[model samples]
Target: MKRKGLRHILLPLLTAVMMLVVSACGSSSNAGTNGATGSGSGTEAASGASQEPASQTASGGTGNGEPVKVVWWHSMGGELGKVAAQLVQDFNASQSEIQVEEVYQGSYDESLNKMKASMDSKSGPSLIQVYEIGSRYMIDSGAITPVQQFIDAEGYDVSSLEPNIAGYYTFDGKQYSMPFNTSNPILYYNKTLFKEAGLDPENPPKTFQEIKDAALAINKTGKTGASFAIYGWFMEQFFANQGKDYVNNGNGRSGLATESMLNSEAGVKTLTWWKDLVDSKAAINLGRKTDDTKKAFLAGQIGMTLDSTASLRGIVDGAGTNFEVGTAFLPKADAADKGGVIIGGASLWILNNKPEEEQKAAWEFIKFLAKPETQAYWHINTGYFPITTKAYEDQRVIDNMAKYPQFKTAVDQLHATELTTATQGAVMGVFPEARQLAETAIEEAFGGKDPKAALDTAAQAITDKIATYNKTVNP
Candidate 1:
């Protein structure tokens, strides 16, 4: 959808062109202000040991000469981390022309910060995996070439890519990055606990009221009830599920976002319901730590939890013998609401400062990653939905989904979701900041503050941030 707003159209053109000019003159990390509205300070902590593979020679290639080296930085860890490493190993073994070195760069927020720092010194990696929230900032950074340019130049057929998954990284009808590991939020319940509580294990809650009722019943049976992370992403998902915009200008997809709509009636209703659930002990306050909540559910202490489908493999494996992990769509705010959840995952982008050979090699690596067979392997091993439509037809994927039906929930939910502005998810440049503010509001409500007052406070703060960001980026 094209935004009617002048700023949305002009700003991107200005941002992209101006950023390129700045790079031509003298590239600096602060060159273009990333065309992002906020103060540009990264809030996430960065810490981890960055490793370099022992072999310096290109391990895989067409055997013409030394393979081109492509440096890749990512944020995956644990079992998912293992799978990512294996993919890199396989990719290296597949060809004799290009070798990719995968580096663990802490969490999403941290990696972004690190990437920016690297760009400032003109020492960034050949390719970097950035989360969906950083899409706008990445575009403005002028540090990477848009994946669309590669597609157009190579005439690569990307019709096989899932529209919803591809939609999140698209702006102005152009795809900025390649969707690699993708996921959506889902309801994960402990089937063993459900049966013990006299609830039908097969029939999971489909609405907020049903969730509350189920939680109450489970609690009455001496179980811990439903609990989830105090994640800002969940707030965005709730608003989308109700077909409500989280910000102005078509959730910032059409134009530059200037304000937050998180204080609207639907927003209040959702926050209030969340606060009441916690207040009544139907939902456990697991704080902002995702691992803590996952551990709680895996230990069978909590009967239900909401998390990304990316967590499915870990949860199922962790919950062994303790409980049967059941999956379902995230409950709607109201039974009458007609909306769906948004996709959540990171994508790959090739840096612009790299050599042409490295750039082409990076593109080759990206193409390999998107192949149906490779994506199928990734989906089955990591519980992330495959990006290509053909990946589902792979025998491995078919067998995996049949063996563990929980993994199918995300694919089913994605197929059922109605494509709309809300489900396209927010594209605001200051979205990360807005999400942090929403999380603060959630914490305040859980701390006994009035839901309306809390959201209003956050909404106003978000408005101020958006205005500042707009001015800073476009002024």
Candidate 2:
């Protein structure tokens, strides 16, 4: 049963403080301190010092020698990170002209910090694992040379690219980065638990109420019902389903002011549902749990979880998880509530240095990574949906999905998703900090603060953060 924690009581005030602390601790903005290169928000590939500025000779700083190392940095972790490492090794072995080096740069925000720092030093790597959230910041600083230029320069086909993905990485009608791993959240359920709950294993929750119902039913078996990683990701998807906004100012990009409208009734309703679940002991509170809710779910303690498709690989490999773990599109409040979820996972951002030859080589490797076979491998191994069309068409992908149909939920959801201000993704400077605010707001409700007041405070605090960020970034 979900039990509220002590932190929940002081959530509104405490959440704001925690966000400040976390952001101060690791928030990455390319706005380096007086060009000292203190931090960059992208991954860095530690390429060996094989080619020097003079050793490389190519037009436009391409540095086309006997194929110097193309260092690539990413924010991938777990199986996702492993798959990327494997790809790097495979690329290095495939040809002698280019060597792609991969490095694990921590989580998405940490990686962004590294990338921005590298840019500040004027010696950044050629590739970074960027996300849709910071695309505006990257474009505003010109930190990234548009991947499309490389695509055009390399004569790659751009028409096959998904228009939604094109919109995701675009600003002012131009593309900046190559879309890599793209995933949205899906409901992971235990079919065996469903049967125990007297619910149909083939049927899953269809609405928020249904979600709670399923949780309550599952809890009847003396197991905790539901678990989730981050509430903001789920919140974004919730708002998308309702056609609401988390913030205005075009999702905090364009350097515009963003009002935290998540304080609205819709948001409160969503949080109230979670609070009810917690109060009902049907949902597990993450702070009090010994094992993470997802981990618990894998271990049969949790009946359900809502996480990104990236969790699929781990879920598949989880020990003592014999129940048929199934996946479905995130249930909405109603059939009329049909908006799609915002995407997660990261993208590839080319750093601002290196010769044209190395950039071309990096582009080549990225394209290779985007190939159907490579994408298939990535999806099967990492559980993130392939960003390219060819990946889905590959026979290997087909075969893998045929073997495990649960993996297809993320892909199908991405294809069916619709783009709105709410679901298009975010690009504020202090996003990680903002997420803490949302989390704290819910913590308060579970703690005993009226859900409405908690959300109002969260919205205000987030608004204040937006203003602070704009002042910091714009001024």
Candidate 3:
């Protein structure tokens, strides 16, 4: 080579470097630009050890390179959690281009807290499953990207997704997260209890008064009447069924927090009904402390309940053969019923701090999950209603519903629902905290304070919280 190049290769000198490099070219470590590391992951190598291969990316619908690895955080506890874990494995096995890892934290709030901890350290999973109410925290924290943009860039067909499914994720007409595991509250009446109470086994309470009367009638049979848990969700659904919105800005789908409107007519009416039940000793106020009431229902100690469709699997599993768990649509408070209940399940959100290539890979897993067949599989395995129209029409969903008809109860409510702002959902800041406040408000109302006054106080507290959170979130 050049004399100057040779001068730099001299041993322990600049001239010696050329000779060393030339001789070492034949060595295995010199095969790649950075030592051609064998792509080992999960542990960093010793100092000067070559880095592994670059992270993979999804090729969208094209059957190109290896599937990307996407980490997911979920809280689909109990049997469904196992099913979701298996679904991830199945998807990873189904495609060579994408691998999904599902991690289960405990309950909904626990999962959110975990994600928040991740945010605090500037490290978080690529995908997070957040309930509808977590929108303010996720969006304001700037942790999640607007998923519709990712779908558009990747050319994934989103037209198949129902607008109603996407409706809850919209903020000022922009969609942040797509749909997953959406559900509405429904009445789970005990057939044997109903029969013993002289009520028709095939029929259930058609209105709030009817439920109260059923509770009173069933109470005579020595069974505690209706056993409602998750008082907030049940009450929210109860309000929606009566055609009243809970949160403002059209339940936060329109824009930032608007007004706390839960103290209105529908709200008071629903709480009044609950109060009446408590006063007449027709029902018991069960908080979120434990599933004691759930155990009571399964053990035939309680007659009816209002819980999520997500509970369907757990309730069935827990019931064993104690008594048949019969499902029905929620009752209306008004004489003229509006429609079905609002959506209440978690949706998967993509983190924005990821590298561009890794982001696309995560998007691949999301698109795979949105497929009709995949959605149907998820819905059948977990009692969540499929968020897509095609999923509802899928043959697998059809067959599964026949076997477990209760799976279709929430789906059926969708059809019966009237188009109203109430059914969309709520978005009060610190809504989780607000849920506790509402519970306390319910307790106060049950203690004989006018239902309207109790809700008004609760709404004022919620409004004050909204102001406080807005400052913390925006400042």
Per-model TM-score on C-alpha atoms: 0.85, 0.82, 0.81
* lDDT of the candidates, in the order given: 0.76, 0.65, 0.66
Which one wins by TM-score: 1 or 3?
A: 1
Candidate No. with top TM-score: 1
Put down candidate 3 lDDT per residue, 164-206, tens digits, no spaces. Answer: 5576677666778877767666778788889999999788888
Cα misplacement distance, residue 71 of candidate 2 (Å): 1.8
Give lDDT tens digits, candidate 2, residues 1-475: 0112422332233334334534653422322111101012112111112111111112222345556677787766544455567777776666667777787766655566566555435565788776555555555454556887877665878776665565577655556787787666788898898999898988888788888889989888988888765355567678777767667777654446567777886788888887888888888787522125566777888888876666565565563348788888887866788577777655777654566667777778877776666766766665556677766776766876886677777677777878766666656655555666777787788899988999999899888877765553444
- Sliding window of 10 residues with minimal summed lDDT for model 2: 32-41
Best-performing candidate as measured by lDDT: 1
In TM-score terms, candidate 3 sits at 0.81
| lDDT string, candidate 1, 54-153, tens digits | 2222233345788888999887655556667877897887777898999988656556666765654667689988878778777755667888887999
Q: Roughly what TM-score does model 1 have, to 2 decimal places?
A: 0.85
Clashes of each: 9, 22, 16
> By descending lDDT, how would the candidates be arranged?
1, 3, 2
Tell how far residue 158 is off in model 3, in angstroms: 2.9
The deviation in Å at residue 255 for candidate 1 is 0.9
